[model samples]
Target chain A: MDISGADLVRAAAFIGAGIAMGLGAIGPGVGEGFVGGKACEAIGRNPDEAGLLTRTMLVAQAVAESTGIYSLVVALLLIFVV
Target chain B: MDMVFDTVSIVKAGQFLGAGISIGFGAIGAAFGEGLVGGFANCSIGRRIGMASPYTRTMLIGQAVAETSGIFALMVSVLLVFGDFSANGVCAWTATLSAGICMGLGALGSGVGAGYPALEAIWGAARQPAVGGQMTTTMLIGQAVCQTPAIFSLVIAFMLMFRNCVGLDVWPYGASLLGAGIAMGFGAIGSGWGGGQAGGAACEGAARQPHLRGPLTTLMLVGQAVAQTPAIFALLVAIMLISIGPTEGTILTSAAVLGAGISVGFGAIGSGMGNGITAEGACNAISRESSTTKDMLTFMLVGQAVGQTPVIFSLVVALMLMFITFNIPATLVGFCALLAAGISMGLGAIGSGWGNGATGAAACKAVAMEPTQRPVILTLMLVGQAVAQTPAIFALLVAFILMFGNYTGPVTLPAAMALLAAGISMGFGAIGPGIGNGITAAAACEAVGNRPEERGLYMRTMLVAQAVAQSTAIYALVIAFVLIFVV
Candidate 1:
């Protein structure tokens, strides 16, 4: 029932780490989805430029995914390292 | 070790719970926000307006804003669970309330703030489908501005849950929290309203003449971004308030707040005046030669971006206030530094604004006289305005170091004087380059218009000359940095 101050703080930090990772994922996920959808549409419209569209989409999606990855790392750290 | 484990576990659990709540709520908010924008994009309005592409992009951005709150909440939750919140002496209630207030209010502003621009972009696209590309740029710039408030809120929330510098027990924790919130709140309002106005104007312009859409949109976005710079700075200041803890007296704390307000407020003035002038120039150019709208718009926006640098510098100053502590011996020196930095930014604003405005005006006139010489004229204008930006950049660098970098005490009066001199140099240094660059741009524009055949030679010569003109500003910057950091 009773808890030590140190334990409480540690627990708080763990939760914080999780929060950083979890919430961070939302932006990139949506951003990547948008890019992917747009790329697909572009490819469909101009199959000849499929390569170009795919490349651009991939590049953009990668950028979009960065934050999500950051979130993931933070989450992992919280669970294991932190 | 056992005791440590026990303490850490409790905190970790709280952290997890907080993180869950933050991200969960943020996700919900983001989803709803995106859905609204997406729905609009896919709805009859979007179809009628012909902004199907931009509409989708806006929806995604809106979702990003909505999701931030959840992240803030989640971060708070995790901090609660894992972090040593107790050692820092942050009352659990304080931490909780701060987190809640930050996420709740922050998310509210971000959601609405981001949405406004999307709506405007949609409307603009609908009215002038031909200028969709330009409209999209304007929309993004405006949206970025609108996001400032939310960003500010996020920064504050993060500080509360993670940094908690207030544990230093320097100032009343409550005041610090309230102050941080207020700083962010006001910043959001300013950026949101300013960006919205600019976006609205761009939309209206695009609708009126589809041919002029490209240049007009670029002009609007640049203007909006410049306008948003101060708000960004304000947010930075709010972050500082929470992270720096507090000063001894109420007066000093209030002074810090007032200084931040002034910095942002003055920054707004510069952005407003500069954006107005640039926009007007763009409008006139678009009217004269609609076909070359794209090049003209790009040049105008680039010019405005240069013009916005001074305001950005002020924001940097505000951020410094949060981290750098001023003692009695250093109080006067620090105050002067802050004031001088602010004034420097303001002065830099005047130079860049006028310089860029003149260039914009010249570009417009040239395009009017010889529409075929658009490329050459645009190139000249951009080069000139870029040169004009040097002094402002110099001031910014000086201000940044004075605020953030470690400084030796003003041991001797001469040393203190050197600081003051450096500040003065930065302020005055901006004027010459700004005015000179403008004149050169105007000349280049006229020359291109007069002899289109000589456009290539004229542009090359103009760029070379502009680079030479920028040298003096660079010198001033080097000198200022030396005085502040090296000396």
Candidate 2:
């Protein structure tokens, strides 16, 4: 019982893509933690600033989220496009 | 059997590897980043438990944004795990490595970098509640800048995966693909860390000294620009490796190809971190001593230059390995040697860079307080940095032996293990010396910065302590030598 050359490659690429995404998530995870930590402190100190702090946190978090997004795009390309 | 294998299986393995890397590492950065933000937000919720509803809405919005990237990674992982491959065999396998590495290391910087400013901004809001708008704007802008490295990584991943762009023959193409990923991934680590350091420092600095915000921002940008060097260097290497055709020869060259990636990738980490930490130190100094800004900048730049040395060494190793045509017999020993080259250089550079970073950080702080002690600071810095460089040298020695050793006998796993052991011995082993030397140098710098009159005492203590610290690295080197030659 044996498999072809092509099948071996298929298996590797699939594994590789998963690895890429998992690794990619590392960036966003750490970045979000920084944001979340700061947001809490802001509310604790001055609840009145909550409105402004919340808005700021959201915007900054979005920007932080970009790397993860980029990873996704790459992972997708690996899966379907590559 | 003509060495025929289930080629299909190999390709499938590559895909699975890529898929795991993309989602796994990608999800990591975002989660941590979200945690940083959420933890801070929780503090707000704790105080304003009555206003929890509105706070929760805001928190969700921020969280949702952070989660978007995770979702994207998840989607991609699902596709890779289940999708049909348009290509197979070598191409697919290469793509997998490329794609996986592209995102794994790439995401490292952005997540960390973004988190720094986000953390700073939240803290800034707490301190000067009125300035929430200003801090938020700064955080967003700064975080956006950090995203550049990750984007570059994504583009390369696309090229490697979708375009099937690794053009050389299987051997070299495999080398380049792997190199490209390593180049981007490890390259980003230092830069992201540096960017975060600079941006975060500036945020805190600006908060404390609103009058000097402009200068602080400029310094942060400058520091970040310097941090980008390793990533840029990595990108160039990756592209060059990709474009070059495969060399026709023994497996030695193929090993060189793989070695090229590891050498540069690991090498860049040190320089990036070194430069960034120094830059942050300088920024910190500036907050304390605004009048010494000019001198501080000079010290910072000089420290950066010094810190980047190990990366240059790595570049040399990569270039030499890449362009040279070694003629070792195609044996397992030769293969082990090739792999050893990378591990030795890469890991060696890691310690050196980190050591330099410690030195650079101390140098900046010293120069800020005691500008007059510049001579002593510079001298001790160089001396300590040189000591830190010893571990890298040990790695180099091992690499040279692996490359040009006299081992034409029949290959055995034990012999090969000796070679591999030598590499690991030096690579992981050097870290102790590298870090110890840096700490030693930094401590000296602090003394000079604190009280120039006590220079002699500082020097003596620093040297003595450094010697003690260096013992571990020396032991590593001895073990490495034993593994390579005696074993």
Candidate 3:
């Protein structure tokens, strides 16, 4: 039952890392899918805009994915540094 | 086993945990609901400068009703913090802690759900001032139904707090009490939120078609009742767990009992919310196409039935866990595996159920737009729903493997941790993909409905997008497998 301060800190950091990535992934996962869905709809309406729409969709997804990336970075930091 | 725990100390600790959990979780729903009501009331006032007084009054009443569940949570928390516990034992400690959890989680759904109706009611009032009074009545009725799940939680919490647990074996009974609380708490969340969504949609519908107010109300009631089915299942499970008297104090039995609660509790959440979303879509569709109210109702029922499949799977797993006994090591590894199995199944079902509901909602609106394409739309919706369910199916597979697997290796701490981590990884990993794929399917359904001639093109697009969305679930599955086998 004996535990040091480092042990407690390490345990908290691990849990925090898990939570950070888990919650963070949710927003981007849903957001990117939404962006892709809209692009599909637009492309369906006019095949002429398919290339441009696909490019735009990629950009939107990348932007949406930023937060998830940030979360991953934070998680890594928590695991490695914190 | 080395530590000594006195009755007073344990009781005090339980009370503190209970009070904190009760207020913390309970405040979430009420605050969300009240804030929504205020926001919408302001919007309504701005829209209808003349009817500001009536709208304000309606907003206040709605906020008041939504606050009831939060108040209930607060009361339970206060009682836990200050009330004297005459009953001392393991039961006293578990009961107090469980009661806090039950009240807190229970209030969360009702509070948020209650707000939806109020906000919509105000918005409706602004749109159709002529039927403002009728809309207010509808909002109240909807909010009342939304509170039923919360009341169920409150009852369970009260029972847990006051129950006689004298001479009961600590392990099984304590775990059972805790499970009962978890089951009731998480179970109420979805039903409350879903019921509110349906109520809000109905209020908006009433404003759209004032003449059909009675029928709209009827539809809302039916939808709300269907949406509450998961919560009802949870209540049944909670009651069953609560009624289980002192059993043999085995760690294995304790794990199974707790697993049952976790399974049904988390399992009920998605189905309840999914059913509500389907009902919301149906209400909106009927309002748009008054001529097709009959068709819309039938479609909504079918969609909701399909949407409940994930919860049904969860219920089956829970029942099995509760009733069936399996021979395994009574060690921590075995306990973790059994518990993780429930966790995997319960969390896995959430995303699929929610996604299916979204797809159903889209299909419902599409059906209203193109009644001629009803069969086609239904087929597409089902396909989307089925695809969305892959993550749940994967979760179920992982759960089955974990529960039934024969391990010849040493029952070490890493093995236990890996088993738990596998479940955690899969359970959460499935959520995003399920919802993401559903979003893709929903868009596809709408697109096809708008352009029936291009059904094939839309279908292809939907499948492609869904496949991409599902990749994340696949990755999670891989991680889970690696944890189970490699780690």
Candidate 4:
């Protein structure tokens, strides 16, 4: 099948965007899971310290999730801007 | 929509494939690594509820560190997905794919390796809540070192995706860049794993035996450092590949590029892991046998140095692959042979690295076991390790033939397939002996540790056994050479 060069590039960009975010989410997902798990364990052990543990866990998870966010932004840009 | 019809060819396919691969592969190690750290952190928290604040804080910081590699990977993917490579033609497209492979795969090692220490630290802190600060410090330091490979990958990826590669025209040169990226990306894995293994072991040792903390830290650091050697070699090879590109695309240059990539990428894996294993072993040995710590450390270093043999051979093969310009007739089979030669050598190096690492670690433990038998154990370990390197050498020989040897007559499709098969035969064939040699080294170490006086006998026996092992690698090499002449 004869495919146009520009069309191929455009399609590649869209697919690339999807992959960028989809794959990018992986790092944050795993990273967030880690912090969440640890926080849960901490809270379980010292219920009294749950507040502090939860705070730390959330903060850590937030940071870990940041990469995913960055990826999303890139993906969006790929779809829209690029 | 209009652009799609206007465009003529599917040249951008590599870019899309590369972008997908980059993002997909890049995120994996980071996520898995985070999981490891987080799982341990949770377990540790459960054990020490009171230290939640400190442990949680540290856990967050560690996870943050682990995310860097992923971030780098993301950057490359975004660049690949968004960037304009249409004007650059095949060279640009191939480079994009290499960049994706480099960053995506490169992130795998450091992202995972860094998390290991974080994991161990969280677990260690739970057990020893008082040393949370120290744990964090140590873990971060180890993670920082482990991140080198990823960083190197990033720099190269950025260069590939952004720059025009310093005017190295033609797809063959771009193909070399591809090889360099592959080398850097895959090479980091074993080293990263090795570093994590050492760092995690250190954290555990320090927590369980506070008195041996100093020694454990030293051993862990040293091991991590040693584990990085092969990756460093891969990096060097990569850099060399990048700088020295062929002026024009040729069957020989394209093949060389493939060879260069495999030579470094696969070459680093076995040794890197083996090095980590050594460090972990040393950490364990030092904690139990602190008195012989120095002597044991010396033995570990010696073994690690020896373990680098395959990597060295790989580097040599990579260098030869790049510099030696064999003007083979332009045929698909000839092209395949070039890549096959490189891949075979690179993969074969894994066995050497694996064997060397196992031997080194076992030797370190043996040193701890029989302090007086240091000389004997060291000797036996070295001998066994040498035997283990035969397969790597065989692979290297095949690589040399593929690079330098002149094939007779016009190349045909079957001939090219035979050459590719030859390369595959050698590449896959060498892995067994490489691993087998490690087992032999470990066994020899164990024998010496158990009976230091019987070192001579063990060495002799191992040599005999190793000779048997070498035969396989030899046969593969012979087959590859035959393919070179016949195929």
Candidate 5:
């Protein structure tokens, strides 16, 4: 069967969208992991400062996750909007 | 009725199916990765230390963040698979592939990279138990660098699949695809290796001297982040290629892509090496004298950040290449822009790296001699480093102009020369600041180490002095930007 221009274009769009969402998540995911890992380590070492460590970890992780969220938005827009 | 149903059915189904598959798989992968790391970190810590570890929850929470991308991908895929959406050919493929790579690789990096730093931090804590604050900071910074590749991948994937600014035909699609892959792959390599090295150094420092943990950790993070900047820049450029496309009117797109890749790759090398050195120095300082750790760490970080400025600038130039459209008469503009930006950053990196290193060493020495004046010493060190950063910033500003500004009208040779001069000015201008700031930081470190009680006053003074030193560099950037954009 002959592939029309439209089909190819449609296919490209789908692939691109998938890539953006997939790749964007990597940084935040990894970042959060590190933050979590450190927090755990800290808490274990000094249970008294658990509150501070947890707070800092959460704040930093949130910042790291921002980019991932941006990527996700883009992916959804691609899949649903155009 | 049958014809209409047939016409819409296939496209709608395909869209929905594709979205669902993409997000569902992405989420699953991320979740699985986070779960494994979180569980491992918690269990390992529990067994090694004790059952009542507050860190267990925090570790899981951090791990959960890493899972966000997976969740995001899942949501997008579900939306695409289930929803009715308009389809653009290039946009669809770019999006899917970009997302897939981002989440899949991101999960892998975050899981492993985060775990490595966490393990180090735990060991540090176990040893000192007092300097936990400093150890955590250092670990976070290293982890952030490790996460760079993942972030870069995600940015590109998202832009390709979701943003779809450049119609497929605009670029040599094959090159773009290859570029995207290279960007993420190289980025991961740089961050992963760099972070590990820096984190290890920080952990060792914390373990050796619990009191000096804060400063030592800060130095480690700064150095690592600087080292990772180049890789991040490359990723940004690759993403820009999709949106900016190659313009026939100006520089060839191929050159831009190649240049961008080279700049970031090279930048990564310098940053990594520089960071490693800084970390070593900080570690040594901490071991010798824990009391003066904070001052020494601050000085080291400031210097390292300055050293990495060139790489950051290079990334900005690459980004400009990918996004900016310039209408200039000369064919050499694109080549010059790319070359100048790359070379500028490369050269600037050398000066800042050495300068910061010297400053860090000095601070270390000063702190070792006089631990009481730590605060004053740190303030001075930061000022010196800030000044040292001027040249790199200048290079970045000039490169920005060449890449982004529109120079269309017929201008005299003098004007062209002026524009070129602008770049040169910033490049050289950075030298004074670099050396000046380094000296200032050294002195401040010494002061703080001698009179810790006067830390507040000394820090304020150093900040003011550094700001003044940075003015010249800021001026150079403004001028270059103006030359490129305004005149």
Candidate 6:
């Protein structure tokens, strides 16, 4: 059975999209976890700083999450544009 | 679709794909390692303005050394892309793809692992400018040891690229070749990372106690050596798989052979990393209190041994799959079962092995902190490690059942898929629980060490947490059973 070039390219693009999302998520996941853990430790040590720590943690996590968002964009491009 | 090549399109496609994969994965580790060096070097330089020149030199040297495996991968990719393959057949196609996979994955671990030591060495040198020379030496040694797995991967990649694969049966032989690549590539990752961790810890320890640099280096070497055992096992399996020249029996046999490679390759990752963590803890412990180096070494070895169990189980399963010839029909169901069994065992081992290492590391630290609580710490660690091992044991049982169970059903696609799903379910299910249990164990050990009087309370609390964590693994096992039996 012979596969057309268009068909093969399409299949490859889909696979690439999936792989991009999968590998891309790993860094953000790890980064966010570290941020949250440190924040919790800080809060525990100084309960008066709980509000500040939580706000800082969320901001750090959001920044870390940017990479994951970029991965998603790339994946979308692969799926739709490519 | 723009322009289609005539006769050699398939081989050309394979070559191009292989090249892309080789460089793509190769880039990840080296870039990460260099970044790590750069980041830490900047931090060190910031602390001491007078040390900027030396720190920069160390960073450059360390980054260059970490780039070695990446360079090896690039060489293979260049060769794959520009090399002639017009006269080759399907065998060459498989060979190129396998070679790419081997080099790409092999470069990953060593690059990241090597970075740890370099960064630590630079950081250490900033603190203790007097022992800068010795710290640099230790860093180089650790980074070099970490690269062993990558070197093994390079050797296998070279073998795959240049070997005479013209006369072999294309289909079954192709799977075996691919399996060889997967085994060597995945196997190298954990060992490289683990060895680097041990090396980095040693450098840090040496910086703290320049007087004990000799003992620190000795412990680092031993730890790195132990951490490398899993990668060695992977190399052995990959070599054996590569040597299996002809496809003998049927498609089922091919599946089993390929499954064997998958089992051994993925299984080694967790074990290598676990041993590395244990070694890192041991190095730090010795640095803190040089008096207990002998006892700490023994404890580290023991912890590493327990962590090695999951990989050993994988090895056994892999060996059995490779050697044993089942006289079953060449049905899709049989093929799925064989392949799924390997997947279940390999993936299941990862979390358990890593979890055991975490427990061991904690226990090692606790022992160093309170020598008097040695008996309680050891017992608690063993118990926690054992609990962590349960998910892997469950996975092994499921793998065995999948491999040896009778399949008297019709050759339906659903049945084959169900078997495959069962493996996936159990394999992925076991990972989180194993790690979670290990975390619980580590915390329990730390608590027990801090207050030896409350050992019983901590032990009980640890067991409860572990049991809760283990529930998810049980659910996965049950679902896997349902998939295999009911579905």
- Candidate topping TM-score: 3
Better of 4 and 5 by lDDT: 4
Question: What is the alpha-carbon interface RMSD for each candidate?
Answer: 21.1, 14.7, 3.5, 18.2, 18.2, 8.4
**Regions of candidate 4 where Cα sits further than 4 Å from its true position:** A1-82, B1-12, B49-53, B87-90, B165-169, B327-330, B450-475, B478-482, B485-487
RMSD of 4: 14.9
Would you list the rank order by lDDT, best first? Answer: 3, 6, 4, 2, 1, 5
TM-scores for all candidates: the values are 0.42, 0.78, 0.92, 0.78, 0.43, 0.85
Q: Relative to the unseen true structure, what is the C-alpha lDDT of residue B23 in candidate 6, on a scale of 0 to 100?
A: 81
How are the candidates ranked when ordered by TM-score, highest leading? 3, 6, 2, 4, 5, 1
lDDT, candidate 2, B75-162, per-residue tens: 4456566754435445567666566767766776566666666666565555655554566555665566666667667766666666
Global lDDT of model 5 = 0.51
Candidates 1 onward: DockQ, in order = 0.01, 0.02, 0.28, 0.01, 0.02, 0.05
- Residues B306-378, candidate 4: write the lDDT tens digits: 7887887888778777777666666675687678778778877887788778878878877888888877777
Give the docking tier of candidate 5. Answer: incorrect
Off by over 4 Å in 3: A1-28, A51-82, B1-3, B86-88
Candidate 5 lDDT, B191-294, residue by residue in tens: 44445456656666766666555665666666666556555665666665555545343334644554454445444444544444555556666667766555
Ten-residue segment with the worst summed lDDT in candidate 2 chain B? Answer: B58-67
> Runs in model 5 with CA error above 4 Å?
A1-82, B1-86, B91-95, B98-111, B128-152, B165-170, B173-185, B192-210, B213-221, B247-277, B280-284, B291-487
CA lDDT, every prediction? 0.53, 0.67, 0.82, 0.72, 0.51, 0.80
Please give, for residues B1-487, the per-residue lDDT of candidate 6 as tens digits.
6786443676677778888888889889988988999999999999999889999999999999999989988999999999966465557777788889889988998999999999999999988888887788988998999999999999999888776766566568777887788888888888998898998999899898998888888888888899899999889988988887346567877788778878888888889898998999888888887878879888999999999999998899888888887656678878988888888888888888888888898888888878888889899999999998997898899889988888987766656766776777677667766776777687677666566776765675566556655655665676567667865
Model 3: what TM-score?
0.92
